[model samples]
Target: MTENKDKQPAAEEKAKERNWISASLWADKEDIRKGAERYGEVKWYKSARFWPSMLVLILTWIGAAVTGSYSEAVGVSVILCPLCYLNVKGYRWSLLLFAALYTFDRVSVLYMRAESGQASGSGLWWLLIWWLVIVGATLTAFRIENYRHKHNLAGRGHYVKDTLIALAFPVVLIASFMAYNIFMYKSSLTDEQRKALAFSYGFISRNTDGVINYCLRSGVELQKFPEQFRQTYADEITKVNDWLEKDEIFKSGMEASLQENKEMLYEVFENGRKDLIRLTIAEETGEKPENLVWKTEYDRMISPVEYCKLMDESFEIMNSTGFFDSFVETVKTLQ
Candidate 1:
């Protein structure tokens, strides 16, 4: 106990003078010259504050990847801490210049998204929002870095010790949080239910069978409609609805994929029926259909790319005319 008490005062005394950068920031040129002679350059990499921010950034990405979600990934702004440290203490304009360049690149992506029906809102509005986020983040980072450097709260240490200590908190927190969630999730299911879910997952993921099943099963089921010559797809409605309502990420993609496949399947059916009539006419009359009838007889022998255009056009027709829901009623009576 006496040894511990003796060490405490000495440790506190060392801590007071440990912030070399802050101590030297206001000292004379001669003091800085002497300190550099002993400690070398005070790089941002030496900042304990910078290391912790980097640790947060790295853990956020790992969380996103493990959860199969993007919210944590979006938290990569935590990295701005160290970058800000680099700029304010080293080259003040570097962050601003990099921001301008990155904004220009992202603008092209945002514009392309707007054109592809993937993004909402006006181009000007989107540009304003992005700039707001970027500018706000840059300024916040600058303030944080300024505070860290000015106080020299970022104490120096061996790189390995600094890195391990910086990473310890986030790693422990995320690991425990994820572990608890996993345990609660598992407890919510019965062993039988879990096995059944595993089986269903395998059935649904007939292609990969790797880890997760990613096929648009609902869309595929919907596409099997009238072509379900063996059995109509009307029966799959419950499964598809359950699948869609169970998850929004799945639900959002469901509509577009279902729309595409629905058009393709429906058009393929119509074209097949029309060609069947022509084939019967040819067989009965012993002659190919004439040019005027040829247009209705053949589907233009389109390539896959051309077929996509036709399907997209067909979706507009089927959707606007209410053919999709009404056609389901017809198939429901297939008994």
Candidate 2:
């Protein structure tokens, strides 16, 4: 009977050891393991709420990554968010900080760039705003759940064991995100697509302004033949320009719009798509892109001054993004 009692304790210890992987996530759980002030502490991980909290944290981590610009606040917020699951108090505090940091990062990016989202015009800020809505919903739901049925877990305390436990969550979150991205890239992207992506990044390096928001590209994805691609871009531009000279559909609209706008319209490229040189004009003039209605194959749209600077040896942007993008799109639509 004594041997059976000894074996029972040994088996229990082994079971705890097995769960230590996930059990390390809890503040009170670790305190109990270390024989600290953790009497009567429940194994909260056994609660179904704990798993749901973990799932939510994982989703938040991904959302932060998707909307993040290359900023320190973004990195910190992404890493720290997952660990918020470590303790309920920590979860609330950490997520609030993340929301603040995300706002800071988004605003800072807009501030740092000469082009404000509203004034200079961008959809990237809208993307950030969308994430805010999602995160806000998540937080609101959390509050409702907490209010209705509190988990009543102890808050985080200053202990090396707990600190280490909290830190591991972020490390895992980051590593998992990276792995997921790599896997997605490898599995989903074709060789041509990846080459196009690389060319897009290369354009960022060459541009004097040096804004290569990875999420947005200048509608160019040329990879097969640069020389031929360039010629195709030129040819398409000629067609568009020629059409502009002759077409009345555009002329009546352009004349009326230009009278008010007074700026040369150019193609503003975005995430694998095109926007407008003047955002309001398209809506203001009641102009919509007709299928095959656009005569221009040209994709790179910049001001005359910016275009001049791009070709200048000093600026070093040689229209690679636009040229390649035009070629690929032309092949898809026309060829």
> In terms of TM-score, which candidate is strongest?
1
lDDT by residue for model 1 over 1-335, one digit each (tens)?
A: 99999999997786566464344323344333344343335455443223333444565578767755442344234334434444434332445644664466568667644433345467667666655555444433344444445656434435565445435645655665456445643234344433443333322222121100111211221232123211433354444334333333333343334333543444444554455556766777788854226663254443333433344335446446764554344333322
lDDT of each: 0.43, 0.41
Poorest lDDT segment (10 consecutive residues) of candidate 1: 209-218
> For candidate 2, what is the lDDT?
0.41
* Counted clashes in each candidate structure: 0, 4
Tens-digit lDDT track of model 2 for 243-334 = 33332223234334432331112222221233333332355656653322432443445443343323332221334435346434533332
Clashing pairs in 1: none
Look at candidate 1 and tell me the lDDT of residue 64: 68
Q: What are the TM-scores, per candidate, against the unseen true structure? A: 0.32, 0.31
TM-score of 1: 0.32
Q: Identify the runs in model 1 with alpha carbons over 4 angstroms from their true place.
A: 1-115, 119-124, 136-162, 186-335
